[model samples]
Target: MATYQIKLARSDTDAARHFTLELDSRMTVLDALFIIQREHDPSLSFRCSCRVGMCGTCAMRINWMPRLACQTRVETLNADAITIEPLAQLPVAKDLIVDLGPFFEKWKRVRPALHPKDKDSKQLAIVPPDSEFGRQAQVKRDCITCGACYSVCGITGSNSEYLGPAAINRAMLRLLDPRDGNVDDRLAVLNDETGVWRCHTQFNCVAACPKGINLTDSIMKMKRSLLFPKKFHDKQAAT
Candidate 1:
């Protein structure tokens, strides 16, 4: 057992609340939050679901870094005190829940759904795993839309109109897919001033992603695609 001092930044009053918890070293921040709410303050509001980290609903600023509360082990912090706050660059809905509306809004702008060329055909367009775009985009496809990338992004902090890393990565996935017919629409968004051009390559999103996705790479690829669209289109078509 260890004693942890949890400092929660409250949005309602723009204040901080301190709580003392005696928790197992293996316990997660989400577990501590639940204990705090149950035993300490019922009004301490936060959002969570699928405590195993699959839902990505428990993302928040833990120790000044965006992370999944459920996956952050108390022992791993190596500190007696922990600072918790809502994700930056977003409106705080309550204590730790930031409105993900802005994040999803950019996600929608990328048109994430697959618009296949032959939607009426029964055949599937399958690119082999050994293909260039397939291998490059495979690891990046695990984004759970947690907004961690958005929270840690430097561009999103200053430029709200910028399509964020997750959204851009979604666009990259579609762009690499030969079957997707809406490439022009996605490219138009990414080629805009507020699109991939806004990213400063600060790589804050890369460091903050719990899924270990290389979001910056996707942004760079899109930038290259914009410069040489025919090459990317030929590669996609060849695959």
Candidate 2:
């Protein structure tokens, strides 16, 4: 067993609350929070689901880096003291729980769902895995919408209108689809002042994404496509 200090950033208090715990090295930050809430302070609050890191509800700022609490092992951090706080650039609903409203609001703006161009066609639109758009989409499509990228983005911290990383990534996914008919509308949204052009290309979202998605790449592609619509159309036509 190892002894460690857990610091909780409380929204209601000026000083962070501290707790000491004796835990196994393999235990995760989520485990420590469970212990603190169950044994130490029942009032302590946070959000988590699918403890294996899939659901993305466990995302928080751990040791000043945005990450999934369930995926962050105490031993791996190599710090005797662990600082846990709610995600940045969002309203704190409670201890370690931030309102994800802003993240989803932008997500909805990108027209995330697929809109088929040939809805009544009997044949299904097949996307070959080896195709150009398919190859590019495969590498960038694993985002779980954890909001870690949104929280870490500097633009989002300053401008609420900016669509943020996840939304732009989703827009890229939809835009790349060969069958999606909502191109004009989606592109208009992406070209807006608060869209891909707003990204500073800091790569902060890339580093913070637990899924390892290249969010900056998606934003840059959209920017390039906007600047050269003919080139973008030619590439898509060749595929």
Candidate 3:
């Protein structure tokens, strides 16, 4: 067991607070926060759910990096002191909790749901695992809406209206889905300055994604689809 210092970035209205806790080497950053809340300061604020890293609610800026608190082991940080802050590029509701409304609202603007060609059908079409649609669906469906990608997105930081990586990633998923009939509408939305054009390919979103989704690759795929419509059209016709 070792004692480590934690510096929490409080809200603008409040001064930052520091806490010291002695914890085992194997304890995660979330575990340390829990100890702080349970033992030292019940008033300390943070967000966490499904401490196993599946829910993605525990995401925060740890030591200036956007990451899931539940998955970040303290010892792996290799720092004597740790700093925790709210996710950047969004409104901070409180300590370590940013308003996800903007992030999700962008998602909605991209029309994430599958607009099936035959919605009235009682049985869904089965896509083979080896098929193009199936492979793309498998890769893109892993997003847990963590917003870690949004936090570190360069385009998002510069342009408030830009559809961040997550939204664009969702757009790519719908584009790859054979059942979705709104391809034209979705592509029209993405073919704009705030759409696929805004992405700088910084790769920060890929690094921040906890699920290991290749967000930049997805964004690039969307870019290619928009840039060379004939290629995608030829492939679609072939399929």
Candidate 4:
């Protein structure tokens, strides 16, 4: 089996030092990390649940791309040397593990849950595939809340209060949800100076999104929704 080399941006209280590990080709970056932790460095720490990449916990910066380590193959990596580091725009608690408290806090602030117009929401007809919001939400709904977007987001780095793409995208999902109620409340939450206003229209969030969610467009939609509420009118009438 072909062998691969992995370099870690080692865990340090002050963010210094690095470690290296070499592994077999078939193993994934996450797999290699686990082996390294279990055998070589027992103190190494990181978060990973649902190794298939659905949990979003395995997300980390792998050679400049925000990817789920669990889903990335060691052999697939291009460079001879790979730099592994914790997600960006977050406080690194240890090697590869970041404090998720802040990320989730922002998520909650955006009201991630869907509140339908009526509690007795029936099996509504499908939204036309060509509709703007529907097409947009189709992409937005795929978000794993992995913090990948948050990691690469410069706006988040510059402004701690910014809701970030993941949160804004969540709000956009709610906006597209026909059954969703609480538009005013959702808008109010996003209207803060630190809310949608903080995005700065950077595409890093979209580039970093592992799920391919059009975060920039979603953010723009949310911003436009606030900028012009008339755009939110029913599609039938707009047509």
Candidate 5:
């Protein structure tokens, strides 16, 4: 076991505090936080659920990178100390917790819910694994709505109205789905400046996503649809 220093940025009071912990090398960042809350300061605040990567609630800025606390092992950080801060580009509700309202508002604006064109089809359609749509859907569906992509997005930081990577990624999933009926509406939403056009293609979102979703590529796909509307529309018609 070794003692390490942890600096936590507390937004509630607009200050940061340092805490020291003696932990095994195998212990995770979340484990250290738990120890701090229990032994050092019960008043310390953070959010987490599932204690696993699946629940994105534990996401924060660790060592200047967005990551799930539960998934980040202290040993892998290769440092004697670490810094913890709330997710970027969002209002910090408290220590290590940012308001998710704006993130979800943009998510809702993209219309993430599936609107099936053929609701009458009772039989389940089997999408071939080798098909283009099938492959794209599989890749895009892995997003757990962790907000890491949004946290690291530069466009979202500068443009408050800009729909971040997560929203765009969600839109891409539905856009690629053949059964979705609202493709035209989604396309219109994405065509706006605050939508796909705002992305600088910096690829920060790609790097930040813990689920490994290729967000930049997905955004580019949406941009291509806008650039060549007729081709995309015709393809949709052909399907």
Candidate 6:
């Protein structure tokens, strides 16, 4: 049996808990955590649902990087000493669990759903599959709203109201959605205080996104289009 350590951090909790697990290298961080909680201490608490990478519930700060514990391998990390904590820039629910309320709230604030685009026509609202904007929207659909971007966002760390990259990305998706009845309406929401203005072009969220989505670039693109419409227009005019 191989021995591995997990360091736990929580909010308002006076002391940190160190858990030691003895198991094979193939065991994941989530596996080690489950065994430690069930066999070692039932009082301990954490959260997970899909053991697969689909559910975003298992995200935690593993070795200071926000990662899905289920997707991370124990053997791949430092076996002797590994720090496990709730995601940063979020309120801690307990050991290894961060509240997702604020994160998801911002997503809703962006109005991520598609709206009716057809006004008077009987024809279906159609967007060509190969359209450049359509492809960008398709990529944004892959976001799981895991709050990983929030954990590393400098804007999120500084401002409680700042909409993180995930929210911005969601808004971008909606803004690009041709079916939406009010593209300008969505832009109004994205132009608010907790909106696009808060981001400082920090690339941490981009680096931390496990899905490899270039979130920062997307956000900056929004900023440019929103803040300086003339710049974009002028460039278009030049062409």
Off by over 4 Å in 5: 12-16, 231-239
Cα RMSD to native, each candidate? 1.7, 2.1, 2.0, 3.1, 1.7, 4.1
TM-score of 5: 0.94
- Candidate 5 lDDT (Cα, whole model)? 0.87
The lDDT of model 1 is 0.89
Q: Name the best candidate (by TM-score).
A: 1
lDDT of 1 by residue, 1-239 (tens): 99999999886674449989999999999999999889888889999989987888999999999999999999999999999999999998888999999999999998999987777878777778888667966798788888999988988999989999999999998888778777778888999999999988999999999999999999998898799877655754664
Residue-level error in angstroms, candidate 5, position 183: 1.1
Minimal lDDT window, size 10, model 1 = 230-239
123-186 per-residue lDDT for model 3 (tens digits):
7667889886788778878898989999899889989999999999898877777667677777
Give each model a TM-score. 0.95, 0.93, 0.93, 0.86, 0.94, 0.86
Tens-place lDDT per residue, model 5, 24-127, is 99999999999988988787889999987997888899999999999999999999799988899888888888899999999999899988778797867567
For candidate 1, the TM-score is 0.95
Model 6, span 1-239: residue lDDT tens? 68877777755465448777787888788988888878877766788898887778888888988888898888888647888888987888777788899898888777777665555657675567786457886666678778899988988888888878998888776666555554665677778877888888879987878677889878888988896544333422332
Residue pairs with clashing backbones, model 2: none
Residue 92's lDDT within candidate 6 is 84
Q: What are the clashing pairs of model 4? A: none
Tens-digit lDDT track of model 4 for 1-239: 55455667766555433445567776788987887788777777878999987888899988878889998887888655777889888888878888877788889987789766567756774677777666876666778878888889888888888788888888877766666665776677788888888877779987777787878888787888787765444522332
- Ranked by TM-score, the better of candidates 2 and 3 is 2
Model 5 — which ten-residue stretch has the worst lDDT? 230-239
Q: Local error of candidate 3 at 45, Å?
A: 1.5
Off by over 4 Å in 3: 12-16, 230-239
Residue 2 in model 6: lDDT? 81
Task: Give per-residue lDDT, candidate 5, residue 78.
Answer: 95
Off by over 4 Å in 6: 10-16, 119-126, 227-239
